[model samples]
Target: MNGVLKALALPVVLFTGWWVLSADSESFYAPPLSQILTAFGDTWTLEQLKADVLPSLLRLFAGFLLAALIGVAAGVAIGSSRRLRAVTEPVLEFFRAIPPPVLVPVIMLFAGIGDAMKVIVIVFGCVWPILLNTVEGVRAVDSVVLETARSYGVTGTARITRVILPSASPQIATGLRQALSIAIILMVISEMFAASNGLGFTIVQFQRSFAIPEMWSGIILLGLLGFGLSLLFRLAERRALRWYEGLRAAQRSS
Candidate 1:
C-alpha cells in the first residue's frame, strides 16, 4: 500500500496541478482536464473500444510475440556459433541502424497496408533489442556453470534449455521490457498509415476533424493503456525472474 502510494504520488500531484491550472483555460487546443475526462467517457464507448482498441492490441501482441520467438531462437543459434555470429554481425548491425518507421513504406510495398504490414513493422522495430540482448546474455553465461552442466553430461538441447536460457534470462527480460515499449509505439505509428480503424487512427481522425477534447481523450487513453501494460510487464518480469532476484539478493547480503 505504501509502495503503491509512493508510485502514484507524483502523478496525483501533477494531475491535481493540471486540473487547478486549466480550470478556466479558454484555449481551443489545450482544453481543461474536466472536459478531457468528459470526452474520454463519451468518446471511448464500448463499441468504439471494440472497433479501434481491440485490433490495435491484437496486432501489438501478435507482433511482439513473434519478435520474441524469432529473436530468442535466432539469438541462441547465433550466440552458440562463432562463425555464424561473425557472418551475421554486419547484416544485423546494418538493419538495426535503419529505423523501423522508415521501412514502413518499403514494407507496405510488399506486405501491403494491412495488419501484416503493421505487425511486421512492430516486429522489425522490436526484434533487434531482444536479439542483441539475448546474444550478449548467452555469450556472457558463466563458464564455470557451463563446465558443471557438461560434467553432468548435459549437452545440446538440455544444456540450452536448463543452463543457457536460465543463466541468460536476466538479460532476456531486459530485452523484452525494451521491446514491449517499442511494440506499443509502433502499434500507434503503424495504425497512422493506411489504417481503417485503431487507436492511432481514431486519434488522428479526432485531430483532423478539430475535435480537440476527443483528441486529448484519445491521447490520455493511449497513455493509460501504456501504463497498464508496463505495470503488467513488471509483474510478469518479477515472477519470471524470481530465482535471479533471490540470487542477487543473496550476493548483496554476502
Candidate 2:
C-alpha cells in the first residue's frame, strides 16, 4: 500500500498542478485539463475503443511476441557458438544501426500498407534489443554453471532449457522491457503512415480537423495505455523472476 501510494504520488501531484494552473487558461492549443478530461470521456467511447484501440493493441502484441520468440531463439543459437557470433556480429550491428522508421517505406513496398506492414515495422524495431540482450545474457552465464550442468549429463535441449534459458532470463526481461517501449512508439509511427482506423490515425485526424481537445485526449489515452502495459509487464516480470529474486535475497543475507 505504501509502495503504491509512493508510486502514484508524483503523478497525482503533477496532475493536480496542471488542473490548478490550466483552470483559467484561454489557450487554444493547450486547453484546460478539465476540458481535455471531458473530451477524453466523451471521445473514447466503447465503440471508438473497439474501432481504434483494439486493432493497435492486437498488432502490438503480435509484433512483440514474434520479436521475443525470434530474438530468444536466434540469440541462443548465436551465443552458443563463437564462430556464428563472430560472423553475424557485423551484420547485426549494421542493421541495428539503421533506424527502423526509415525502413517503413521499404517494408511497405514489400508488405503493402496493411496491418502486416505495421506489425513488421514494430517487430523490426523491437527485435534488436531483445536479441542483443539475450545474446549478452547467454554469453554472461557462469561457465561454472555450464560445467556443472555438463557434468550431470545435461546436454542438448536439457542443457539449454534447464541451464541456459533460466540463467539468461533476467537479461532477456531487460531486453523485453526495452522492446515494449520501442513497440509502442513504432506502433504509433506505423499507424501514422498509410492507415485508416487506429489510435494514431484518429489522433492525426483530430489534429488535422482542429479537434484540439480530442487530440489531447488521444495523447492522454496513449500515455495511459503505455503506463498500463508497463505496469502489467513489471508485474509479470516480478512473478517470472521470483526465483531469481529469492536467490539474490539469500545471497545478501548470507
| Model 2: residue 214 alpha-carbon error in angstroms | 0.2
**What are the Cα lDDT values of the candidates?**
0.94, 0.95
Compose the digit string of candidate 2's lDDT tens values, residues 2-119: 6557767877899899999999989999999999999999999999999999999999999999999999999999999999999999999999999999999999999999999999
Candidate 1 TM-score versus the reference:
0.97
* lDDT string, candidate 1, 10-86, tens digits: 77898899999999999999999999999999999999999999999999999999999999999999887899999
lDDT of residue 158 for candidate 1: 97
lDDT of 2: 0.95
Could you say which candidate leads in lDDT?
Answer: 2
The segments of candidate 2 whose C-alpha lies over 4 angstroms from its true place after superposition are: 1-3
Model 1 regions lying over 4 Å from their true place: 1-3
